[model samples]
Target chain A: GESVGLHLPTLSVQEGDNSIINCAYSNSASDYFIWYKQESGKGPQFIIDIRSNMDKRQGQRVTVLLNKTVKHLSLQIAATQPGDSAVYFCAEKGANLSNNDMRFGAGTRLTVKP
Target chain B: DAGITQSPRYKITETGRQVTLMCHQTWSHSYMFWYRQDLGHGLRLIYYSAAADITDKGEVSDGYVVSRSKTENFPLTLESATRSQTSVYFCASKWQMNTEAFFGQGTRLTVV
Candidate 1:
């Protein structure tokens, strides 16, 4: 079955260092891809997104890179902060209006050491 | 006060019990979705609605039911809860086809 997956279950980084999380998906028919940040006990928060037509997109301090050929996705955060410590997830949107609105990766726990 | 919200932030129920999780959004978005997050598993889509009265099942919809009587609400019902149903559920909505989804605080359900 086609699904989204993460490269690592957890990641540790220095407070001021950069952080990168990776994900791989199998569906090429997806409409777009999104990265979400989830704090403990809270819902996933939308961080950034990239459309299928584009290979990369950037937000305030975040960036999402998509590699269609390998069906891979990645989220890069510049200057990791203590508040950036959370579970990050990558998801690929499903077709237009079918059941699969988005398929998510298991998630990577990003721990920033202060 | 204009974002998505889920009721009973947390819940505990026994196996075989019927439970319904509520999700409400004030944006009047055209799309709403329900997803469950479990340990070691990616968030799984249970159901989604393109519009009021239009609903469809997702990858994991076997034991779940959903309805959207109004554009602002999409509730998920578990006919008979099982231990495996213990997980965090999130409700989200997007304004259009190509947009970021706003998520609720999420409901942590524990089936004992």
Candidate 2:
């Protein structure tokens, strides 16, 4: 789901369940995308990344999927844990834009319930 | 140790006063960026530098200023602090265009 006004889109899931976060980007030419996990009062931590050429990329218990035609990106977390509760963001950079100028999407808050 | 560092993790200032947030990175990355995170808005870029002294404005750069005089430091300054400027600030750097950016702990600013 997406955000509503000042309220962030929230996803509440049970522990040990799988979590899927989706983001729709605007730039079709974007060749780079990244997913960040940010806990309260802390900076964003890079979780995973995907390039335009790749449909999917995986990390420790996490995966990133990119659909260039639809300009969509998603993050999948396996075996969700309480420690995994945080705000997740998706960033994109087009081929014409520098990677350092990555643009971020409205974050989605993931809450893991015991 | 070998990452980006932001000074004065928390700051409080008057609305009309000027405030500066400091960012330093040990990685010697070629690019540095400043972004503000608001409640509804995710992270929005304020300014960025391709290298030392090559700063450029991002999508939401109004009422703010940034200078990159050295490769290791990039400072963001609010000429006159406003209530709307109060938010968490993050500094990030990337060594190359294809790499992921590393973020600092962040600085929370409050304007009274």
Model 2, span B4-107: residue lDDT tens: 99998999999999999999999999999999999878898999999999999897899999988899999999999999999999999989887889999999
DockQ of candidate 1 (2 decimals):
0.69
Candidate 2 regions off by >4 Å? A1-8, A95-99
Off by over 4 Å in 1: A94-100
Task: Assess each model's interface with DockQ, reporting 2 decimals per model.
Answer: 0.69, 0.79
TM-score of each: 0.94, 0.93
Candidate 2: clashing pairs of residues: none
The worst-scoring run of ten residues by lDDT in candidate 2 chain B lies at: B38-47
| Candidate 2 C-alpha lDDT tens digits along A48-95 | 998899999999999988777877788899999999999999888875
Q: TM-score, B chain, candidate 1?
A: 0.97
TM-score of chain A of each: 0.94, 0.89
